[model samples]
Target: MTAPADVPPEFLDRLRPICRELPESYEEPAWVGVRWRIRKRTFAHVLTVDPDHQMAYARAVATDEPTCVLTFRSPVDELHALVAGGHPFYKPGWGADVLGMVLGDGVDWAEIGELLTESYCLLAPKKLAAQVAGPAGLCC
Candidate 1:
């Protein structure tokens, strides 16, 4: 897939390595920005939300400026705690397991890496998923 012109190259630079490490994962251009997938299932998607066009994300974050956003799947048990904090995180008005995060200053790349790993595990086929280790430190 061609690189998405809307997403900042720097953002792709940070995300590409983490997604690449997963077995069988690949990058593709999404309708909006870009998405990383394990086979056909998307685990992580990044897009820039312009309040003028995307009201849902703009309202969710309550920001007037264009904001870069990353959406991913989170385990149900951890969803509330992550979104409850609010600022950088929010529940998108879609899938039960889907969550959106505002990406900008002070964002944690390490945490993003861990979360993306978990997201990949959740969507990838069982055999392929088993080939890669889960996030560091916490247990299933």
Candidate 2:
């Protein structure tokens, strides 16, 4: 996918709080990546090795990356809106070609928590199974 052009106003409105609260767990080394961290560890990233400006958010760690890269189904109208410039990224787990599902700019903070919770659940160590916020009450 190419860089995105328009930032979704509604999505940003809801994403700020989660970004504020998710980073409270760290006081030592600090997390890695561009933005968004959980307990001082990276949970989301604006920078990427991917050339499309494709951002990544945690959806369960895959390989060595802290978060899975965002991907979406191709040929969708929302993605088509980003022909010029915008932050290009997909919802992790969905492939790079899928276009209908765009992540980063249009999601709310509660949704961000929900998304992170899901990712944490996916990548979370088996020992933290009960502690990691998965699907139940992540928004609260």
Candidate 3:
């Protein structure tokens, strides 16, 4: 299947390697769009239903919501723009990828390891989040 124009292949490949696999036996609703819920609430964004685009994004909240998604935050937009040559647009689950690139910066792979660890702190079930982390970018 063809991927949406807004998505990059490397980007999708990078993300699918990190997130939970889409359930093959499950079905999706019409026009509701593909969505991935981060931390179950803080973020929710649409994805392309086409099999090729392994991406996701957050549901945009009211502008005044302080707890709005970080992906929507200016820094993320600006950083992504400079880094990926795009605007605030995201392809879901890509945050984990960025967190790795952002934290690594050539000198520290371990820092990326830490950010991935903390990501689950704000993302996983309390019980799982409490367990000591095993590895970052390791099949989630």
Candidate 4:
């Protein structure tokens, strides 16, 4: 499928399905990148790579080259584990429960899908989450 002009094709290919499948999920422009929301609350967001921005918060994490980063809400333990896992994942200096991961080559799409599912569960209302979680409490 063709991606939106502003979104990376690879990102759309990998993440769109996961986000779209969840009930009450939608996407919108989030300043420089995009954000996926459930019940009007953002569960995942992405930012365009920008090394030279006036606001330090706007700059991407220190990297050798430009790289888009996908940030998502995560449980604290999971957040730390992702960081401990190595490159491609790190904590952005933002929300206490939010973590950032560089999106590029070698990314583990399956793991990312799991994280997104978890984030959706966290933000989605209990009833909606239960519906998405299916019979075994696994993501749909």
Candidate 3 residue runs with Cα over 4 Å from true position = 1-5, 21-35, 42-117, 131-140
Tens digit per residue, CA lDDT, model 2, 89-115 = 332444443322234434444644655
User: Candidate 4 on 1-140: residue-level lDDT in tens?
Assistant: 11221447778778889899888899988866788999789998876565543144334367633467788898998889988887777877778888888777787888888888888888898888877764367653
lDDT of 2 at 4: 40
- TM-score winner: 1
Could you give candidate 1's per-residue lDDT for residues 1-140 as a string of tens digits?
12322777788899999999988999999988899998899999998888877788788778777888999999987878999888788998889999889888898999899888888888988888778865444322
lDDT of each: 0.85, 0.36, 0.32, 0.76
Better structure of 1 and 2 per lDDT: 1
CA shift of 72, model 2, Å:
12
Tens digits of lDDT, candidate 3, 1-140: 22442323443334332333322112222233332344343222223333233223222221221111122112344335544642222323444333212111132324323433444345555665545345554323
Global lDDT of model 2: 0.36
**Prediction 4 global C-alpha lDDT:** 0.76
List the candidate numbers ranked by TM-score, top first.
1, 4, 2, 3
How well does candidate 3 score on lDDT at residue 27? 20
TM per model?
0.90, 0.34, 0.32, 0.84
Between candidates 1 and 4, the one scoring higher on TM-score is 1
Q: Candidate 4's error at 75, in angstroms?
A: 0.5
